[model samples]
Target: MITVTLDALDLSALLCSRVCHDVISPVGAIVNGLEVLEDENDAGMRDFAIDLIRKSARQASARLQFARIAFGAAGSVGATIDLADAEGVARGLFGDEKTKLTWSAPRALFPKNKVKLLLNLVIIAVTAIPRGGVIDVAVTGEAEAPVFVLTCKGSHARIPAHVEALMAGTPESGTVDAHGVQPYYAGLVARAAGMQVGFAIDGDTVTIRAEPAAV
Candidate 1:
């Protein structure tokens, strides 16, 4: 029988905790909004609450879907992501805006884990742009092992350095660094996956790739 080290198990739990901590804010907001709507008595307030609930729900769903891809167990070999639903989730992250999100993927349950990771990463990419812009998300599998790729390009300024290191899994400690410059919890997630993550920045394009562990 193969035994796992305590450190390894602890690291896995720590990573999972990080993922939950990162996602709880958006998901918790949805729950809180729902509670407020259930008890509020004002008509205008109720309408506002409804919008918040919808927005929060979409946000929570997107995070969950993204988590499933990034950290959850991968079930089957070939699965597809629903482009329309994905677009809706992507749009939800941008709030009520004119951001255009174009999803090019088959409509099916592709690999659950891959889809989750891609969704989270894409949302992270889009969130970096505040002024709203066009986003294209695509997914494909390779012959050797399944692979997922996300390419985000916007006319907004270049990708932030911290984010670049986070995607590349090379974050410095906030306390020791000159600035509180560690990547967000999500970047810690990419690192925990034990996958080699890479970032390519050219002109106005920021391409990120998170590949599954090679077997």
Candidate 2:
């Protein structure tokens, strides 16, 4: 497998840029809504502004929560994160998206990095089905050495070529920017956890599987 590495500072900057990119729209919408609330005289317009503010606030919160786990130091090294919590954040992140999440992982606690990898994979899976679809997540085997299988089903579902290249650690993926950083980070997480991630596309379904790295 090809290996990819980046300076710690660069990785952090790219991830931060990505997180900002995800939440900026909603945050900006919230501000716009507030402005409308302040300036609009029509009662109907005021009600619309309030509704927009509420929804945008929720979206921003969800993205932040997901980023906290997926790209942040959620806890002390070696700490464990509950799968149930992971499911909650995953659902939250999917709340406003066309894609839906169906999680089947156990409710037990697993290593922080494992949970991080799962969340990152969820992000990648949802992207496979941009036209709105269902992503079914299943985890099997022991908690410490579990396998993750995410099946994404939707019309015209397909993994992006850049994402594929980044996941494979190929030089052809080019510079790691905000758009490509997440997949690269996901690959890093997998390797850090002593696991390998693979992807396959079958018709309208894309399956992402991760398991113990071959010795």
Best by lDDT: 2
Error of 2 at 195 (Å): 0.8
Per-candidate Cα RMSD to the true structure, in Å, reads 6.8, 1.4
How do the residues 151-192 of candidate 1 rate in per-residue lDDT, one tens digit apiece?
666677345556655444345432212121123334444444
Q: Which stretches of candidate 1 lie over 4 Å from their true place?
A: 1-6, 26-40, 74-99, 106-117, 127-131, 140-149, 163-170, 174-197, 209-215
Angstrom error at residue 35, model 2: 0.6
Tens-digit lDDT track of model 2 for 77-114: 89899999999989998776678788897889988888
Off by over 4 Å in 2: 1-3
TM-score of 2: 0.96
Clashes by residue pair, model 1: 66-116, 69-113, 69-116, 69-117, 70-117, 79-109, 79-110, 80-108, 80-109, 80-110
> lDDT (0-100) at residue 203 of candidate 1?
66
